[model samples]
Target: MSADLIYLVLGLALLLAVVLPIALSRCAVSAPIVLVGVGAVIGLLPFDKYGLDPVSQQAFTEHLAELTVIVALMGVGLALDRPLSLLRPRSWRGWSLTWRLLLIAMPLSIAGVALLGWWVMGLAPAAALLLGAALAPTDPVLASDVQVEGPSVTDDHDEIEESDQVRFALTSEAGLNDGLAFPFVYAAILLATAGPVAEWGLKWVGWYVIAKIAIGVIIGVVGGWLLGKIAFRSARESLAVARRGEPLLALGALLAVYGLAEVAQGYGFLAVFAAAMTLRSQERGHEYHETMHSMIERLEQILTLMVLLLLGIALTNGLLAALTWPGVLVGLALVFVVRPLAGWVALRVGHRSEPIGVAERWAIALFGVRGVGSVYYLAYAEGQAVFPELRELWSTMAFTIIVSVLVHGIFATPVMRRLERIRAAAA
Candidate 1:
């Protein structure tokens, strides 16, 4: 096929990918479904019309997903309207779900999969651990249906209904877990390039983990606080940049906080989220909050569609060619079994305001959709170190991701709708 023809086809594909899905939004499916389908079709059409061949450029894939993730992280930060205090029991309940999921469920899921990778898949310990860390961060792209929407409001009189505690906790947890998962990935990389396993045991598993988590939180909090002050105070006073109604200024907050946190070797994911919370706290009743969130959300949706499309192209072009039975099995186990078990265990403590019914809890557990974070982790790992079974690992991760996307994507709206109905009926 001619280059011009390929370009024309790609342009058309992009247009259809965007327009058709928006038209279908009420049907409970998404842009992802359409994009993935279009990408797959384009890949099979005997032309190089829609391939992500640039992914063959290792640095490109590494950075594209990296950039995509951090951008999404910024959006997540900008959307949160809640304060981070755990004082009220309702607030504390949200935090409880978050902590249990992150501290207990996340690690347990990682460790279980790591063990499976080691024993069943016969991967090296480092590689196995890397897989665990890579899969740990639930992708916000697929979990958007359950996430909190818009900014926090301080005014009780403004009259917007608050997002449910479950949604807020899950959304916020996904935001920061991406960064927290990084330390484990770093540990795996360290082990991959280590001299002695014992030294790694002490330095990496012990000191490094502690230091990284501490630094990430500290940098996020401090950086976000300062950035919030500048955004609300300096900008308001200067009047030169004081467009109080425009939320695009939230973009400034995203960049400033994310940039500094990374420079300080902190988790940019955490920093972006903390910064959002900080900014929300600054002017809780400000009308700009929703405007900012709306803008970020639209951009996030566009990015998500593009990523999902590219992922379909990747898969259609044999991204899973190297996946062994064991590798594939492990990935499936994670989405279907490991996560569900861990989620159930984590929430077993019972909700402070009467736990969700078994049906709702199960629905929530099963929909821990894996998306962009797995892509970022795979690309990040590829950058840091090479593994003997890299192709198998990549294929497994991609398969799991695709499966999760389809399964969860198709089910999210329906499940959420049903849950809401159930709650309403009970009330």
Candidate 2:
């Protein structure tokens, strides 16, 4: 591609980033569908120079997806209106729906998908586990409609205005599970490199699961607490820096938490989210939270648009050519069958309060929107090890993402709107 062509494409993409969301705001159409459609159309224009090969550009694809996800994770953590709580039975009611989804729904979804991949899709154990882990976390990038808007302010520190159950559930689930899914991904990697689970089960459980999770949580809590103190409280002499309304500080914090956590052999996803949540809690009613969130949201929007556009281009350029009937079936099953079933089961078993009704549970269960997270995991794994069925894995993941963007995207606005109305009426 020439420099001029690149500029033209970038200009058009930036224009779409501004226009599409406003145009599609209250309609059945969604920003993702439109952005992807535009890219598909552009790809079909007989312009050989515009196509991208995701498999060939794996590192670029991984990093782009990684950046977009971390940005979204920060937004997710900031947007939450509910406070986090411990998982004791006495405190279960105080626990957020995010807890149920992470502790219950996510594992069910992962297991269901892994079994389907192995038995139904005929993938090997390692590949099946990888597919499960990759598609397990709900993508924050494409789930804007189902998430809390931004930082909410209230007079009483203890008064958390109840968010709509569906939004809270999805937002919390996506935020935490993005990090929680990492251990399973590592499990797949270990299995791929070292042969059988029997050989690495003990080490995987010790290092990948327990140790890494502990390190990530400790780092996130400590880092987030210190950053919050610096940003929100600091010496009077340095208070000017806190009041300058620099939202880039949020980005800086995100990078610091993520980079340091990863360097320490911890899960960066969890650390980034934990830090954001901790920071938000520091000055829960601060206008600066809104400033920081809005900044992250805008960046997330642009990156999401770019990724969906590339996905569309890749689709048009035969990304799904490797798709088989079995792959298509598995993809459809994941969105329409497995996720909903797993979500419903989780809620049924886990929910203790009367806050979430059947309709809310069903809506939350049905809308497990998977997008860039799956792409990142796949790309990251593909870089680490060779899988003979790489093409099929791509085809399955791509097909699933397309279905999610279209199906969930089309229904998200209308469904959430109706749910909000119902909650308001009930209130």
Candidate 3:
């Protein structure tokens, strides 16, 4: 209870937060799970005398998770080295994964959630839609663990030129889709408030879907282009900034674009990501790519640790109090069944790489690791809707996210190790 003891405790936690992640890096375990476990154990003790009131400020928990998610998005955007394109040769193979994730997997996932909401959970249609949208976007922070290492694997000029197909696509997709999933959440809110589907049908569809998506895209392209040009070439010493390797300029671009887009009512997530991609494309062969990526990645890792620890605190404090058995079953189904089936269908189109064959593809799909982003969306949606099922939905989403982090985190390193050996043998 003394100030000195409090400071000591804080210092110890901070140390664990840093060291545990590095120590667990190549193992099948993850920093998030460990932090959560520690927090839970600490909570179980009679620590109320320590004066840490975890329940009074749920808002703090939500905002911390939100900040962590957005910052991770910025880092994800900054790490992408490939130029944007619809064509396969010019894009990351993860691009196909992104496309399939959005076009097929996303919609199907939403529909599946909605159906379960209606039949099993007995949730209202609007509440069902909200749950769907909230759970849809895969969290970039957690995916970063399983994602391929940096944009350039080989230092060789010829080999380094080959775009990192998997990481780029997954990072970019997670960045943009977080915002794209918002319109659906908004639509659910509108439908909940307004009368029925037929009444506001075309009008609501146009405004939320067409108008919002358009505004987000336009703001992204224009804002990103302007910021990229400024960050990369506005000064008289334009080439000097580039030559000096100032990667913090990337952070400036992220804040500027995200802030401006939010002010204009466009999706800030889309804008931040678009700006990063545009900047990367400006000098695709620049040596500074790794410099910028390394800096952002470090910051992202720290933020991830803090967020996961807080999430663990919340779980210990009673985040799952309202969870039901059916809800638990639904969450498991999403992880094991829906995601794998979707990944299989998406990759069924085929790939040029044999190492990432059908079996590998299935593994990737099955491990659709959810984490902070899902937590943010669910919390944000709860503020928007208070349906009878809202509490249950929150519990289920939290349960699913925790399960995914533990299961996938435990297996990612081992599985990736195996896959790499397999690829090497085949080669």
Choose the strongest candidate by TM-score: 2
Model 3, TM vs. native? 0.87
TM-score attained by model 1 = 0.89
> In angstroms, how far off is 157's CA in candidate 2?
2.4
Candidate 3 ranges beyond 4 A from true positions:
1-14, 49-59, 85-94, 153-169, 238-240, 349-356
**Best-matching candidate per lDDT:** 2
> Per-residue lDDT tens digits of candidate 3, residues 1-427?
3465345445546688568767986677777778778766655665554433223344655676777776777677656644574234655543656676677776777777777767777788998888777777778888866664555533453444323334444555677778788777777877777768888779766876777666666776776567556655666675446667887876666677777777877777777766666666655556666677777777677777666655565566676888888888878888887777866676565454323565467665666777887777766665665567766877888788888888887877777677667767877
Q: Give each model's whole-structure lDDT.
A: 0.71, 0.85, 0.68
Q: Considering TM-score, where higher is better, how would the candidates rank from best to worst?
A: 2, 1, 3
Q: Which of the two candidates, 1 or 3, achieves a greater TM-score against the reference?
A: 1
The RMSD (Cα, Å) of candidate 2 is 2.0
lDDT of 1 by residue, 251-278 (tens): 7767776787778766677777766666
lDDT of 1 at 22: 59
Any idea how many clashes model 3 has?
0
CA error at residue 101 for candidate 3, angstroms: 1.8
Clashing pairs for model 3 are: none
